[model samples]
Target: MTNRIERLNELDSYGVLNHKQDEELNDLAKIASLALNVPIAQITFVHDEFTFVKANIDVVSTESIPGRVKRRESFCHHSIKNPKETMIVNDASKDSRFINNPFVNSDPHIRFYAGKPLTTPAGNPLGTICVIDNKPRNLSLGEKQLLDILSKKIMAYLNNKRKLLNQENKIIDDALRLQNLTDRLPVGIFQLDKSNQNNLRFKFLNKTMKEMCPSVNTNKSSESIEILFSSIYPDDKNRFINHLNESFDNLSFSNIQFRIKKGNNCAWFAMKGNVERRTDGSKTFYASIRNIDNQIEYEKTLEQIAFDISHVLRRPVSSLSGLVNLVDTKEKLNKKELLEYIGLVKTVSTEMESYTRKLNDIYQKKKEIITNHNKSYT
Candidate 1:
């Protein structure tokens, strides 16, 4: 009636099918049974093919009511057809619409029925709270009003359940979306808990963390700093630990570069993070680690080149200047003296050639490293 697909979608957004019954809904059904003085009272949700009994109370016999049944067997189906008002049948045996109904003709043998539709906030009927009796009788105006009021109470309970569930689902969805975004990044995002100063642990680790540290256990709350230092080069281990300790004590930001060794291969990583303090005096460190092996190697090579230009190249150039000055002072140079100067110049030129070759090799290695790293990403 309410555009079947749209109605079902709205129902699904509430997420209330097949879940365990709440005590509040059960108590409402009990109250309905007592107030109406009926042997059977139920809170039902009518779907396309079935009627889901959210709550039920039967006092006539020891027989238990089912959680669900075919819509054809449920009077709640007829109740929802008129979403605006209640549906009452004083004598089901005489009503042509339900005279041949299986529920009336055989089991349960309902002769009196009163059902109030449970409508949604948008005025779409979800189901009903109906009372059934075995004997034919008329309902007083007060009785009908009481049933209507109870139906509204049931709807209120359902609406609250839906709101709480929606909030929980939103939280889970947001967390998953954040994780997906971080997974695409090349850097390793992490949060560290140093509250227990003696036992450091990682509260969170993105995908890149596992890829970067294959041997480290990500699931356990092991000593993260200890594991980290063990994987780092021996020469850098102490400085790295000290830097971390200093940051924790001062609640300051840290930016440090260090080398990590996995198996025999080593790579450089640059870590940058800031400490976040809590009202309870605890702290968390959020950080990102980026692979910087190529950058560091390039810088080291450039430093070496600078040293060569300043010290190594200067030695030979200075020797050549001295030789040129001697030639300028002499009016005529003898063959033997010219030969000695020529030999000295040859030795200096060879040294300069060696320095140029070293510079070329460093540049070539840096180019290869960059090209390979880029290709790996593609």
Candidate 2:
């Protein structure tokens, strides 16, 4: 639970204190002044140091008088002191608190005051809407009830205004957070509207996405999906589009491996995304694109090594095994045949050695590619 001062600070957070006078608030004060036939009706906001007038209406005109007085002299301050209830002084001259008060003893010569405490939904008293009279008087029960109801309306307006301000701030914060998260990620994130296949539009492209394909224009709606496809190699672009459409139609996940044209160079990328069906029967896709040139190259190198082992080395190894079996079966082979078998085995062993050198060369190249790629990204 917050005390009076703490509650005042929370009220201040809404920025309503000492603000430009509102005509609407002034009109409410006018209505109160007219109904009660009082000289002055005010909507006041109380702070630790002062009671500030938000709306002040006289019986003749509903014009606001904006100023502040010390908290001790403020009638609204006493209203807020009592929680959840209006404070009334039929004759301030007879009250002990106001007996020696400057406002009561001097200018304005306050003699009568009746105030309903304005409160937040959490029951924190903000200030009051009260009427003041120069002559000692009392408010009818009907007039007091009207003031109470008017005070509640004023609080409702303040609460609604605060909600709108908070909502606007939350939207701004969310955008900044989204940008921060995407900017730090290594992979590019994107969103594309496929609602109209003929006019596939780029809905969003984060910082990484912009950097990944510098050639593609990032302007939303204006930049078509063709601009993105243009960055991709011609041979792979069609296949990529086809696979994406298939995924969209099936409402399944999309995975695409393709080559992107980067100026004079080409890079391999792996892209994955999912299509979201809109309530209007339209669809959008959110995706990530990662530069996988190094990964793809390394995989290709491994495949080549496997191919050499199974095809090139396997043939020679098989021939050597057959020759060895023939030699073992023949108990007494001729010297010429034995020498020929030994020569054949040497040839087969040299071929296998060549395959090993090829594999080693591929591995060294793959390692250099990986190291250089990492440095480029970093």
Candidate 3:
């Protein structure tokens, strides 16, 4: 009895018994009952103590009636033990094993039984396809063969359904992963779908995109691209349009810095994106917008500082250099007199000019560094 329990658990682990009800199994049950001319036909997973009905024909109970017989008293328990062989009881009342069985002696008496075991793809018996009758009857060889064929069909249907369910679960998992990644991305991402020759709609926008341009959520009826262009400064509109058109034509990435007006205030944004040609002769544009106003201002300030150093300090440095040459080349009347003159001129020109040139070089190098940093924005 313990061995029977272990075997039943093993069969249950195959998951065939866990399947959902479908039209295919119902159709098979109907056909089997009609062909066998039986009042009841069932696709059942037989366990140690009970049978689980997967599909049934003309059975009042959708599930098996509990305790119709004990585990040791069931013929299904004996049949599943030799899964490769079918079990047929032509006369249960005459069979010694079933003559005194509770099911045969009392209500819902059973006298005829035929069962073919249903096996998994790996050839383990999971359950049975069975037909039952109240009176003793025998099945012809042809009928037995037909039952075997239907059992095989049931196995094939179960396998196909398992595969489809697994595939759907995988698809759902992948979609969830992608959605999480998109939402947590650092950059502000947006998608524009071309609705027509002149209209583009916002198909999607991530959280960061909405925060960067609050007005982007406005003008719900207007197309996304049109609204974006309308926000651009009038002076930069042509250049922005030209760059966008060029990017589409070449099917390449584009980077453009333009000023956009939000209400009465204006700021600069660096827009970068790619144009993708879809299969339906339409286009999709994906882009990220970064606010670059502060960076641009910092770069301009550095440039101005460099210009001031070069122009304001060059003349003084040159004049000091000439004065230093004069002092170095002139013959000295006396050591003391020459030293005094040199000290006076050096203090007035040479030292001052040298310090100015050094300051100028420092400012110029700072400007170069700033420019290099700003270039990485796009």
Candidate 4:
């Protein structure tokens, strides 16, 4: 049990104690009032100096009743002292504890009283389900039992309502966080529901997607995916579709490079996605689109450079090998002539080794550059 003053102050802090109305609470009060045949049944909260009715079944003129009344002056306050239990006073005037109370003896008297305390999740009492009457009357055991059951129902309703509110708030918070992340991403992100008649639609599109395809409005429902694919290069469109189908059918990640016509220019794009099959024999995919035109062009240029180096080195290497073979196979000659031929063979061998080293270095560097670029795009 909490100190009466402390409990009253805690009730005030709930904010629902005063000027808050709920239709559900009012319905509960009405049911309790009818079951007990009481003119006044209320969900009340006790503040520092007063008991405020949060929900009432009947019209009551008075408000802010004194909370710190003496034991002999307040039946409602005494009833809520033990929050864990219900207090049923069949006749307040007949009860020895509240018979001499000033409120009962004077005007706006309380004769019949019954109250069940309301507590929070932490077991702190906030208010009560109370019934009062101007005339003294005894209630049956059945009526008391019904009032107790109604109080428990009211508590359950409040608990469930609070849980629902918390869940709703969490959902809203998660949505905002997801939106923030999507907006900041540099690549185009989208989801496709392949379940709908082999048609791919964008379930999500990031800010980058809007910027990349300014003419493709995602907000419209009639935007056909086929129309989008039609913009792709004729030679690459079938291959791109084939790759996408294979990935989805095999439940593997798909990586595709294709060219699309953007205005008068042709641009290349790299797409990566994962396929997911639902329980209902339907599939979906999530993908990221990236502009890889510059990367592809750079790769082509590197390949051409490697080819040119190989072409230039091929003639020199062949000539050097022929000269070495001829020098080794020739008949005996003068000492000076033989010595000069040997020196010429050594010079050609050295030149061939240098060209080979340069070729290997270029090949290794090109591989490294391509690997790094692929990693970045992925």
Candidate 5:
């Protein structure tokens, strides 16, 4: 017995068992029947439980079953067992192996049965290309040779078809995988037309990017560009436009960060891009946009802290230093001077403590905000 799993897999590799790919095979079957002078001819594929007929010529079909048959009942089943040669029964009624077969004894009443297995290059048998006749007959040497040649032609056609189908499947798989991978990224990725300064047409936008700029429309390039430029915070608008236009002209890009006005709120976005110019002088800009709002807010908090330390803490720190210097210089200070200096020292310490507390509070709030922002992305 053949390795049933490998045989089934070999049959599946053809990719024609489930659908109708028999237009060419049907023509081939017709050619076989005409050349062999048989009442019926078919190309079949056998799986685990059923024998599927891909192409047939003049085979009778009942409404209940169509052109398929149980695997055990098919003449092609027996034909598949011997992959390298034909199984020809010139007279089925007199043959011991098939005398009680339903197809042999009833319906098509196959008295003459000749089948050549449809085998793969790996010696796995799929099914058969066979001829059937109601009367007993013998095939001449020339007729047998013709059948061999036709079977080879059928296999050649099927192999070529499988190659094309696999190639198409590969392309579709690659595209879907790339799309899924890009959609899951944290940054928004896109492609835009860079043929001219006025055109801002988007050629492609990943899912993240589509959600990022919901207001931008692909169909209206110039209008969309206007909207984007208008949305930019006025301070950075001109600089952003200049850099983008220069990048388009130079076919190189540098990083830039700007704020985009989103409703009443704004977001800080950092953009990095590269330009691809095709040989046809057409150009496309591929870019990634990352939301850096948290980073911007954190930086602002740090700057505020620096400003406070420079302005608010400087006065008390300088006052404390001067008080210490004054005490050090006067070795014979009077009681009243000692008392005043002590009071001044206490007041400066109190002011320093208050400022330190305020700074701590500011740091704590900013730290919590940044921590929460980072957690959301993870």
Candidate 6:
């Protein structure tokens, strides 16, 4: 809804009403004072509940303290009400509006008042830059135009303040969003300065990076790198470091798979990285690390199953084929030969059944282990 509080936020962004900055607007106040031939000048902001004075030139204050007045006591209240036009009370004693006003009857003893509203681009009036006099006097048309020009200058200064404030806030907002996004990512991400092998250090690291390598310290680059490598499984540590060193020396892409100790257990991981070379001949590496424990387990299981089929069942199947050929060649067989053939057939069938059962038993055991391991991750 259209309301005074709605405009308060945008007006507060200029930072004028928070405190008195008499020096900031004193020059403008001086111009208004000298041009209008008045002893008093001020830049004030009129809100719904109070009138806040940004700057004052003379001893007269809207309140007992400087820079504040209740809405009921502020003459600038009328100025904001009629934003499109200037309010001029040439003789406050004669004007019905100010005849009983506190500023006119009591302190500051208002006699003449002239104010131009500081209007926003959206046509909302924030307050006024005004000149006041203790003695009565009217303004010429040229003098009125002069007051209008001074008001424009005041508005221009406040508008510039608002723009800069908004820009600074926008920059802070963008930075926060980027930080949160990197933190929530699943894979660990890091940036390293590869300018010198001896000076290799992490320049940037995401939240996941710390989670992966618990001892990592971004501030101590060499020590953090050493800590991370120490967690690698003994068998794969050398291969991973060799690839990384080669990539750093040639400024080339690197990819490697390794395992790291996770307590008494180990987990598999793959790392991929590429280098960016600056025009100054300095190199940097952008890297990512991903967990590959499940994938590694699956591939190993498949290889075991293939080995069982190739090696375990091969001898039994060959023996069955030879037995069939031998029986066909013995057309006129004796009783002993017939019995021998039957016994051999019985032995072969038993061997085949036993081997098949062994393969099934091994597969079921592997499947159970995989299922339980996967549950822990979930």
Among these predictions, the greatest TM-score belongs to 1
The Cα error of candidate 5 at residue 272, in Å, is 1.9
Arrange candidates by TM-score, descending. 1, 5, 6, 2, 3, 4
Clashing pairs in 2: none
Lowest lDDT 10-residue stretch of candidate 3: 60-69
**Candidate 1 per-residue lDDT over residues 74-94, each given as its tens digit:** 888888888878899999999
lDDT value, residue 32 of candidate 3: 86
Q: Tell me how far the alpha carbon of residue 174 in candidate 6 is from the true structure, in angstroms, after superposition.
A: 4.7
Tell me the lDDT of candidate 2: 0.82
lDDT (0 to 1) per candidate: 0.82, 0.82, 0.73, 0.73, 0.81, 0.81
Candidate 2 residue-wise lDDT, 1-378, digit = tens: 448667977787667885687887888989888889898899888888888888887543333333787988888877887757778898889999899987677766778899998888777888889998878888888988899889888888888888887888899999889988887889988888877444577888877777777766655534788778778888898899899879878878998899888778888889999988899777888999999877877788788778877886778789888998888999898999989888998998988888789878878987997889867864
**Candidate 4 lDDT, 1-378, residue by residue in tens:** 777666655554444644556999999999888878777788876665556666776545264344233333445566667878778776667778877777677645777788888876667666689887878776678877787788788878877876776688789999879877986787777776776467676666666666556555656534555645776777898998888889878889988888877678777888998999989877888898888865886778678777866896777677777876877787767899888877886877787788778777876787787777556544
Off by over 4 Å in 5: 22-41, 57-73, 91-111, 132-136, 149-180, 191-207, 210-249, 258-264, 279-281, 321-343, 376-378
Instruction: Please give me the total number of clashing residue pairs in predicted model 3.
Output: 0
lDDT string for model 6 (1-378, tens) is 226766787577676767646575779988888878887888889876899888777755454325788877788988788888889988988988788887888768889999889888877788898988888988889988998898888888888878897898899999778767877887888887755444667777777776666667645534446767888888988998888889978888888898887788888888999988878677888999877777888899899888988898888788889989998897888999999988998998999899999988987888888888766644
Q: List TM-score per model, in order.
A: 0.82, 0.69, 0.59, 0.58, 0.73, 0.70
Model 4: ten consecutive residues of lowest lDDT: 63-72
Steric clash pairs (candidate 6): none
For model 5 the local lDDT of residue 278 reads: 79
Q: How many backbone clashes does candidate 1 have?
A: 0
| lDDT for model 3 | 0.73
